[model samples]
Target: MAKEIKKVVLAYSGGLDTSIIIPWLKENYNNCEVIAVSGDVGQGTELDGLEEKAIKTGASKLYIEDLKQEYIENYIWPCLKADAKYEDYLLGTSHARPCIAKRLVEIAKAEGADAICHGCTGKGNDQVRFELAIKAFAPDMKIIAPWREWSIKSRDEEIDYAEAHNIPLKINRETNYSKDKNIWHLSHEGLDLENPANEPQYNKPGFLELGVSPEQAPDEPTYVTIHFEKGIPTAVDGEELGAVELVTKLNKLGGANGIGLLDIVENRLVGMKSRGVYETPAGTILYKAHNVLETITLDKETFHYMQSQIAPKMADLTYNGQWFTPLREAIGAFVDKVNENVTGDVKLKLYKGNVINAGVTSPYTLYDEEIATFDEDEVYDQKDSAGFINLFGLPIKVQAKLKAKNSAE
Candidate 1:
């Protein structure tokens, strides 16, 4: 016997898995009233007709929350400031999950729901991300993961179940990929992407949603200038814009030049390796520009330490759905302090998927031309290096002398 659930709030995306989840929850949870919640993190037209679809599919009501500005300013900017990337992959989907789940919990509470449900599959990392976030926000809320409990074995089976229940679906058996899209990035998985040996069909029409293939990009290169204030982007190409507008503009420029495309076999939190293709467009360009600016703005020790130590850990924490944890908040504080002087502009040339660093300029730059130049300077004498080298090599010189003395003896 299962515990009775009267009502449930679902984190709906109007995607295939979520499309049928409304019906599945009502069928299994004693006909519980389902309230659908969708976070609009720059998914654009995907949210169009979502309310009608949700109502038709048995949801009592649909809440489409506009989280675009919040997603970029709070979530995306923090990740950028920390320079968080998992295995060289821009953590687009990983960070977006927490933002969506947080909003879902809020809606669940407001709706007076007994439980929160999601369409995340048992085998994927999303289930862990969603559940961990929900647990952090509302520990007492019951989590109902249909994929873990239901008997559906494959996507084909899920489609059949949806058809039998007359649940309208936007996908069919011919659907070749499982994709998640937001303002930050777009990810593609399943289908031919499952086999690591198969090369992605980048040339195929409709293969990429964010940008064209590098091969299809124009021959002429496009130049972009990104301005930053304390590690947050403020403008592009001399046009000052807000967080959302800046990213949207960059996405268009970078995508047109075929800038941000990646295919990798990444390790999932569930202890399995999965292949995914990602189109980051704007994110890739932004990360590049921010990093270049940091090169000039941050001191040697802090910059090197951030790149060597803080970045990887930050990436892991973000990817693991620990955004609400105190540790992540502390890390954010550290990143914020480090970014106090990271105000600058970076110019780049986008050509055939390459972000070439054209130049970087900053008022806080620590680089001293006179000190670094080869010509004679009044700052100091080059001869001072002799004494410094002698002292620095003293231990090595002593060890060598002792070895020689012992060998002779």
Candidate 2:
């Protein structure tokens, strides 16, 4: 038996799967009201007419919230500061889900809805991301995942349903690519991308949206300078800008240079491998700049440990939707403390998908030229190396002596 649900708040995108969901919830839930909620995370032009479209599709009303700034400052920055990434993906969709889910929960409670619903399929990692974040905010709020319970088995079937219901869909069978876009990045999956053997036809007109492929990139390189204040990107070149503006500026430059495009077959948290092509122009540039800055500013141990030991953990947590957990917070605290001194500027040359470091500068830089230079210096490190090498090599020397004695005996 279906539970008593008078009203439901739905996570809606203007996509094919969600475009039909507003009407499906009403039809399946005995004419229950659906309050469709969409988030604007810098997916420019995607939010257009969402309110009109939602209401036209039997939604009681629609809420489109601007979550770009909050998402960057809270989600993207933390991951960047920790230098976190999963496989070949930059965690763009991974970071946006929690922010959207939190807003969905807020709207659900504010509207006094009986249950919360999402358009995420049961097989995808987004289901875990959405449901976990919803659970964190409203433990008692009943959740509904339409794809898990619905009879529609594929995107083609969803298009058919939309047609049957007289609901319009932006994508048809031929151009149906599962896509997620935000300020951080744009991702494309499904269609030919499902087959790892098939090369992504990036030059096929509409295949690559963010920028041109590296093959089509200009011959000349583009130089960029990024400034970091305590691990947060504050400016591009010498011009100070907000997070959104800075990222937008970098995106234009990086995209033109054919930067931040990757094709990966990653292991999903649902225990399945999936193919996705991601274009993260600004994120790629920022991560590269931050990594270069850290080399000069951060200490040997902290830099090594953060990138080696802690970054993968942070990536897993973010990718797995464990952002609200205590462990994530503790890890974030440690990252923040370590980044307290990571203030620097990094210049890079972006050419044909390569980010080559040109220079790095920081007031707190640990790179002392006097000690590190090959020429004669007054730091007096040349004579002391013999004693240090002897002590450092003592264990190997003792082991060699023991092996020699054993061979002689």
Candidate 3:
């Protein structure tokens, strides 16, 4: 049995699921009042008219919180500094959920709501993400997940319910794909994407919202210089921009060049394999540029260790919705320490479906041209390598001699 609830705050996006959930909660929760809250992480016009629609559906009031700058600075930049990528994914959707959920909790507390609601399905990873984050912030708040408790089994049935209740929805039964978009990236799932064998139709109209196909990209390449301060991208093409503006600018540039399109079947935290088509135009560009700067700035051991160990761990934590965990915070501190010297400039050429590194420079670069020169220099002695190699290969030579002696016997 569920606990009695009076007021519920819903994390609403005005999407198909969330649109229907407002009425469903009222019906199931004994006519409880529903206050809709939408977090604006650069969804552009998606929030337009959301207030009217939310109220028309069943919500008492709607709050659209502009979290774009906070989302970029707090969530996106830390993941970027950690170099976190889930498999081949740039983790655009993964990193946004916690920020949205955190805000939802805040609103619920301010409204004095006893319960919170989200539209995430039982089969997806988002339910866990939303619920865990809510628990972290407000442990006693009741969580209502419609998909888990309601009898509605499919989107088709949800559409029927919406029609019977006179609820307006932007998506219908014929909707080809389900999409989630923010400033950093846009993700596409469902429809033809359910079958991994079918190749994505990027050329098809409306299939891709953020970028054109590489074939459709301009013939000539475009060059952009990215400036980073402490591993966070600060500017593009020598123009200083804030976090949101920087990502927005790169999205347009990289999208024009068809730089970030990925078709991947990834393992969900719920122990299911799901296929998704992701467009991470700006994220793809920044990751490449930041990595190049790290190569020049970070010492050999730190760079190798980060690549081999820290990065994958961070990726796992972020992908699993463990952003609020202490381990993530500790790792973030270490990542920040590593990024202190990562300030630099990286030049990249954006061609069809490629972000090619053109140049990189940093004030804190560890590269020594004089010592690394092919010609003889005062910094190094050629004869020193002979002794070094002898010592380095001593164990190998001894093992070989022992093997030879044993073979002869």
Which one is best on lDDT? 3
- The lDDT per prediction is 0.91, 0.91, 0.92
lDDT of 3: 0.92
lDDT of 3 by residue, 1-409 (tens): 2347889999999998999999898888888999999999988988999999999999999999999999999999998898889998988888889999999999999999989999999888888888888888999998989898999998888889889999887776776477999999999999889999999989998888888889999999999999999999998999999998899999999998998999999999999999999999999999999999999999999999899889999999888889899999999999999999999999999999899999999999999999999987998988999999999999999999999999999
Q: 285-380, model 1: which lDDT tens digit per residue? A: 999999999998998899999998889999999888888899999999999999999998999999999999999999999988989898899997
Tell how far residue 256 is off in model 1, in angstroms.
Answer: 0.4
lDDT comparison, 1 vs 3, better candidate: 3
> Model 2 off-target regions past 4 Å?
1-3
What global local distance difference test value does model 1 have? 0.91
- Across 313-384, the per-residue lDDT of candidate 2 in tens digits comes to 999999999998999999999999999989988999999988899999999999999988989899876879
In model 3, where do residues sit more than 4 Å from their true spots? 1-3
Model 1: which residue pairs collide?
A: none
Worst 10-residue lDDT window for candidate 2 reads: 1-10
